[model samples]
Target: MTMTRKDIGLATRRAVLGDAHVARAQEATTAFDAPFQDLIAEGAWGRVWTSEAISRRERSMLTIALLAALGHDEELAMHCRATVRTGASAEDVREALMHVAIYAGVPAANRALKIAKAVFAEMAADTDQTDSEKGGDHDKG
Candidate 1:
C-alpha cells in the first residue's frame, strides 16, 4: 500500500538519513519548496531510499560517488548531508572522494570536496547552535 505523505516523508527521511538530518530538512523547508520537498521525500527518500536491497551505508557511498562523478555539486552536498543518517563515516566519505578522483577525474572530486566541506561546516555550526540553545552543556561534560 502507498503511504501517506507524512508517513512516507518521515519513514524515508529516518531510514536513509536519520531523525537529526531529516529534522534539519524539515526546519529548512519553505512554502515555495514545500511541494518539491514532499515529492523528494516520497520519491527519492521514501521510494528509493526505503528499498531493502542495499544497506543505507552502501547507498550513501554510492550516492556520493555518483554525484561527484556527474559533477552534481548540489546533489552531492545533499547526500553528504544525509551521510550521517546512513552510517557513513568521515573516512568512508574520504574514500568515496578518492575513488571519484580516480574514476571521475580530479576536478570533479575537487568540486565535490568543496561542497562537502561547506556542508560539513554548516552541519557543525548547526550542532553548535543547538548545543548553545541547550545551555552549551556539551562542552562542560
Candidate 2:
C-alpha cells in the first residue's frame, strides 16, 4: 500500500515529536486554525523534516538554532523537548545555541538556553516519574 504525503507527514511528525505532543496539538486544534495546522503538517513535516538528506539530529539542532535566533520561544521549547525523539543531545543543542549566540546575538542564545534548560528539566522529571511508575530502580534503596 502506498502512503500519501499527508500520511507520510503525519507518521514523520509523530515519530519526531512523539504521540503525546501530537495528541495535545490535535486536541488544541479548532476549525479556525485547521488550515494552518495542515500547512505545518504537510509543509514542515512532510517537505522539510521528511527529507533524508540530513539526519533528524542535525535537523533538530538546526531547528532549535533557527527558532532561538528568531525568538520563537514557545516553539523553541517544543523543539527542545522533541530533541529526545530527534536524538539531539543537550550538548548538541548547546553547541547549536552557541552558534546562535554568535550569529543571532547573545541575548537570543541566552534566552533560548534558559528555555532549553527548563524544558530539559521537565523532560527529565517526566522520565523519572515514568521510570518510578514502572518500578525502575525500586531496589536501589
Candidate 3:
C-alpha cells in the first residue's frame, strides 16, 4: 500500500529526530501550533528529508549548517542531537560548522560549535547511563 504524506513524514521525522524527541514535541503541541507541526511533518520531514537526492547524513550536515548560519540555536542543538540517529559524525559537524565560519561568519560558527559540544556531551552521557542500566560496562574491559 502507498503511504500517505503524513505517514511518510512521521516515519522520516522519527527516524531522523528520534521517537523520544518527536513524542515530546507532539505532547507539547497546542492547538495553535498543531497545524504548524503538521506542516513541518509533511513538508520538511516528508518532502525534504525523504528525498532520494541526498543521504540522511548529508541532510543532517546541511540542516546543522543552515540552522547555524541562520542563528537558530535551539534547532541547531536539536539537529546536532539528531545526528546520533542520522549517522552524521562529530567530524562531519565540525566540517559543516567550519564552512559556516567562513560563509556565515565566525560568530555564528562559534556559537554553533559551543552548542554542538554541549549536545554531544549530553548524548554521550545518556548513552553511558543507558549502557550502565543495561549492565554493560562500556568504560571498562
Q: Give the runs in model 2 whose Cα sits over 4 Å from its true position.
A: 136-141
Strongest candidate by lDDT: 3
Q: Find the 10 residues in a row with the least total lDDT in model 1.
A: 9-18
Relative to the true structure, how large is the alpha-carbon lDDT of every model? 0.84, 0.93, 0.94
**Backbone atom clashes (below 3 Å) for every candidate:** 1, 0, 0
lDDT of 1 by residue, 1-141 (tens): 876865875787776666777799889999999998888877777777778899889889998999899988877887898877788976788899999999989998898888888888999999999878788675577
Q: RMSD of candidate 1 to the true fold? A: 4.5
| Estimated TM-score for each candidate | 0.68, 0.90, 0.90
In the range 1-141, model 3's lDDT, one tens digit per residue, is 999898899999999888998999999999999999999999999899999998999999999999999999999999999998899999999999999999999999999999999999998999999978777654454
lDDT of 2: 0.93
**Candidate 2 lDDT tens digits, 1-141:** 998777788889999989988889889999999898889888999889999999999999999999999999999998999998899999999999999999999999999999999999999999999988778567665
Better of 1 and 2 by TM-score: 2
TM-score computed on alpha carbons, candidate 2: 0.90
